[model samples]
Target: MSNLTWQIGCVRVTRIEETLTTIPLTSFFAAATPEALAPHLPWLRPHFVDAQDHAILSIHGLVVESQGRTILVDTCIGENWPESNPLERSALLGDPTSPFLGNLERAGFQRERIDVVLCTHLHFDHVGCNTMRVDDTVVPTFPNARYLFARTEWEHWRAQEDPGFAATLRETVEPILAAGLADLVECDHVVTDEVRLEPTPGHTPGHVSVRIASQGKEALVTGDMAHHPVQWAEPTWGIAADSDGAQATRTRQRILAQHTDDDLLIIGTHYAPPTAGRLVRRDGRVRFASG
Candidate 1:
């Protein structure tokens, strides 16, 4: 994992990159074909997207430092731990060895010192590192911290008919609950003066985005609210992973409408390197502008 960190006023956000990979644009965005992405090539190339139209995605977690507390936003795929489904598996490289714990300590964060763990949603990838294997059993990675989960998010995945998602709930989430370490919270619950969880559903029934404001500066940690930056270029474009496309579009619109400027720093959980940037209104449409 790469130690890429950014600061937003009094709060500092660091990217504990799990893995960086690419997938075809056609396969990534449901409404976009390779042909449709052609026009946006000049702006997208060599950074967000590549020559073959693959969208670059980084699976990682964000460490939010504020108010003398260390909070981990999302945990990435495990260090030596493997996953069952394709979604979780693809985020890994062959014999993936991104020593998650080693990297965390190297970044000056002690696992046992993490005050809280916030999962934006209960997708397999986002919650993979919630627990780490200990010889024969899986256990909560951060033994001394409280894990914050959205109540609706927990029930949504637990009742999923898809076995893959169900397996995810069993593997990644149940362990936390079993340990008496989870604190199921509502979507609008506040974490701190600078960090708050706000519903941005659509990717899932209870999806959320984190809002951070400090000293007149602001930032939004977008948890899959919009996967690729290209979506800002074409709002209609979307991904198949979304459980509710219409709702997701509305949520994406809401984000772009509010923060398409420098005043709000938009931090993407899955965007490639230099992942944190801002959006802008260009020719009546929202566009991804460097932050």
Candidate 2:
């Protein structure tokens, strides 16, 4: 695999896949079943362990580097999150792959070098790698980095009563806050000349996309606007996990519209390798330029 890849500037980007599993199509859409997802089989088969069908399973992470700082956009499902669904909980914890931290080290990024860790939202998969397990102690993976989060999102999730939410706040977020390392800002906050956060709510109350602009060139790190490129073609196809499906579709429509005519590079949190791409119009509709 290539050691480094860039997106129009000094910003180097990396895509890391965490796990893959399938779900019943009916769970996400009515009148859809295992057979209904068959049309997507070709696009998903090779990535799954053994593509067998109700749906395709996949999760990913993005690492962004620019100027003198390294930032992780989102963390995958952490090691010990307890899912209410027994099957999912088992698959999450029992997967034979590896500890996510090892993958970071393999990519040549020590946790200490990450000067900032940002999440588009507070979903479990996006915040999993926030902490590391060390001899029964869970600590921030990037000990020297200030964890940045949307102020509204943090406050909203912080008020939730779930154990996982509490674990993320108390064990991951609050520790950084207590240590004076949490930088909570509004959705449109700009962290640097090369990067800024654009509010794209609906998936979560405070979802935001990270925009990287330099030398008059631009790239948008779309956190979770549309989970799959299929959504670029079918704007109404939202995942069951979305907090606000209608709003998510509207957000996707606006973001997609902005990039459809230009050579705007897009990086999706759940997109596969060479995950970044250009958006173009075709047949009176927008399509992601896959490579």
Candidate 3:
């Protein structure tokens, strides 16, 4: 619930945090071991790492408001999910005891007031809050909002047989579809004048990074293309969850190339504190300039 807000002309963006966790670098990036992170430790510590040398990541919700529409990008992990879920045991451990509804309220975003809900992919943390538990039944958290999803992304997960992910799809995604609130859209679909989806797949088959531009400023809300700032520095690192490491690396490099040596703010979906930053070029290498 930090007072984190960004303004880009007529657009306003805010972060409603659910939890912060420190996990092994290898958990996400297979090549980013403790020894590999040794040189970056000075810059990464005190904010992006803990005493135990684990990399820190946050799970939160981004509230974007523009043109009389309030949109939420990626609902953080909600409580009441099954314990057997691997993602729940990863780092933060099962939603971190927060009531997402109250966090949204504290962020000045009422559940009913949300005009649209966009999921970058069908991942557990990204879609956990899509529904809420009312008594014993799960239902749409944003009763009036249209849940926008990439048709390809939906179909990929929908055709899967994994019990854990399927449970997440059942409770978090299917309920919205059953309620007739789901809007399956193209990967590049536009949400508002200043906001639109940019297909940056590979982490998931239909992954996308959101772009926001207004006046002369711009920012990218990276869904899962690059989960950490270090990826910008070393684009070849492989992420364990990515379906295709080569494709994910390509997407990461593409985004880095666009933001490096520019003013584009890159807001990482799971980046640690001061989560929003810009990519810079130094000595022909990429560096992160925090906002």
Best by TM-score: 3
**TM-scores for the candidates:** 0.93, 0.85, 0.94
- lDDT (tens digit, per residue) of candidate 2 on 46-87: 432134444444566677877877888887776745334334
Give lDDT tens digits, candidate 1, residues 1-291: 357787878999988766778988887776687677777777677788877778888887899988987899888766424355754564453345555567778888888989899999987668878887789788898999889999989888888788788777777789899999999999998998889999999888888889998998888898987888888788767787888988888898887777776588888888888887788776675667754
In model 3, residue pairs whose N, Cα or C atoms come closer than 3 Å (at least 3 residues apart or on different chains), thus clashing, are none
Model 1 scores a C-alpha lDDT of 0.81
Q: Give the lDDT of residue 77 in candidate 2.
A: 74
Model 1, residue 159: distance off in Å is: 1.0
List per-prediction Cα lDDT, in the order shown.
0.81, 0.71, 0.84
Residue 36 error, candidate 3, Å: 2.6
**What count of clashes does model 3 give?**
0
In terms of lDDT, the poorest run of 10 residues in model 3 is: 86-95
Off by over 4 Å in 3: 83-91, 94-96
Instruction: Return the top candidate by lDDT.
Output: 3
Higher-scoring candidate on lDDT, 2 or 3? 3
Task: Identify the superior model by lDDT, candidate 1 or candidate 3.
Answer: 3
| Model 1 misplaced regions, further than 4 Å | 79-92, 96-98
Tell how far residue 247 is off in model 1, in angstroms.
Answer: 0.2
So what's the TM-score on candidate 2? 0.85
Error of 3 at 136 (Å): 0.9
